[model samples]
Target: MAAPAAAISAPGVLADLLPASTRARAVARDAVLVLGGAAAVGASAQVAITVPQISPVPFVLTTFTVLLLGAAYGPLRAGLTLALYLVAGMAGVPWFTEGASGFGFPSFGYIIGFLVAGVAVGWLAGRGGDRTVLKTAGLMVLGNVIMYAFGTPYLAYATGVGAAQAVEWGITPYLIGDAIKLVFAALLLPGAWWAVNKFRSQD
Candidate 1:
């Protein structure tokens, strides 16, 4: 029988950086990645700054982390990382924003969006979208759009507000922050690539 696939064989920037010579080594690397990546995302979710004006949707670093993870890990592992985070949070890990955890929370939609964004960003990164600043930023913008696609409608439904109100509360208020995040996330992948190349040259 053919060997089983590695946990993180899906192509992306980080996968290229961490290639393994053997299937066994690849599997080991993937194991560490699955667990460590999930934990890192969970921890990032905890860096929440509540905008009372944007209650139920605090300004957290989760989105930034999600985008970065996806660009680094590829779609499958990035999606799995977010899924594991959701499961742990739902199971009362208190890792969600402001130490909150549950399925019924209004902000839960964004968490779901994280999974979608992860896949989208990872796919784009795998396609070399992450190699350049502009392309990477564009991919991050797409990821952000995917996030709001889930988040906006859910915000409307959960709060019993109209679509306009949902946009007002959940979308508009965060546009600047999201843009800032996209720029940073966009820069990260290319920067990592530069760092990797630099380190390789030193060897």
Candidate 2:
């Protein structure tokens, strides 16, 4: 005899919220989570903060949203969420940062990176990486590095700039802001877990 549905392990915040008794409900719940997560990411991308004379890339809230999604959802759903965002944007939805779309744009590299980072960070979170402040922060930094890994090279290629200048323009200007975002995400994940635990205990 198999264990009851409630005995099954819930890997992340989202899994905890969904019913595991049937495959159909699980599929529907995952679909809803992925769609909702994609919308949230798109909404965050629109909240861009521009800083001219520094770099072409503007600081956006997408990073924070991505990290949160990864921590809340697990790797597969998080990746799907980001993939949906990319596909929707490519299909002419102005959900990319600064209300832009299409595949040819240089910043789209970062968007691609978002998918990769979401998967990586979500995997980490699935393993309890986001349960502690230090571990969560480290995972957030890993996500940022993954984002820049794809972003910086494509930035150089797209802008017709040399490698050095690409670092200056695409990577350097965003370091401080990324660090701040990293810290914020790090704190937020553990705090959310604490709140979730507290609520569960009360229940």
Candidate 3:
């Protein structure tokens, strides 16, 4: 038999594609997703390059990973995932950028922002924001802006710099990279949805 119309029309996030036949099984699945997602973000955080002359905030893949995971996981799962990552890092897991831990770091605010942005993107994705290239692009941009909103002010406070200087140090140097990542996600997310639909149609 063909899949249900609701299933075809609204698959929700990518993770929703997984089957969970029982309540206990569904709970177990979500638990695994949260743990795995958090670990993925932490692992991505290590892929960083610091150009202190440009900014105290190192260029890291953490934001990209977090945003994508959020879209795929949906709000509750993504929020839990980021919460796990944040708490573990603050508790000295040393899984943060450059294997650093604790919260006083200049980039910690960005990490905090990740939790909020993850939830935001996941909420958007649940409402079909990630189903098309244009929507995905806009979603990614909003996620990045949310991060900067939280990150810049905290950076200023941590580094004892003025707001303008904080933007210079924390936001300016990353614009190009953020744009690149945004474009990549815009294309990749919609493409994944297309592929999934195509596969489902074939089945």
Evaluated with lDDT, which candidate comes out highest?
A: 3
TM-score of 2: 0.89
Write the residue-wise lDDT of candidate 3 on 99-153 in tens digits.
9999989999999999999999999999999999999999999999999999999
Q: Write one digit per residue (lDDT tens) for candidate 2, span 15-81.
A: 4555656988888888999999989998999898777687777788898898889878889999899
True-structure RMSD for candidate 1 = 5.4
Backbone clash total, candidate 3: 0
lDDT score of model 3? 0.95
Candidate 2: what lDDT? 0.84
Q: Alpha carbon lDDT of residue 157, candidate 2?
A: 87
lDDT score, residue 125, model 3?
98
Question: What lDDT, from 0 to 1, does candidate 1 have?
Answer: 0.82
Could you give candidate 1's per-residue lDDT for residues 83-181 as a string of tens digits?
888888888888887788887877888988998889889888888889889998998889889989998899888989898888887878788988998
List lDDT for all candidates, in order: 0.82, 0.84, 0.95
TM-score, per-candidate, Cα-based = 0.87, 0.89, 0.96
- lDDT-wise, the better of 2 and 3 is 3
Q: Highest TM-score among the candidates is held by which one?
A: 3
Which regions of candidate 1 fall more than 4 Å away from where they truly are? 1-11, 198-203
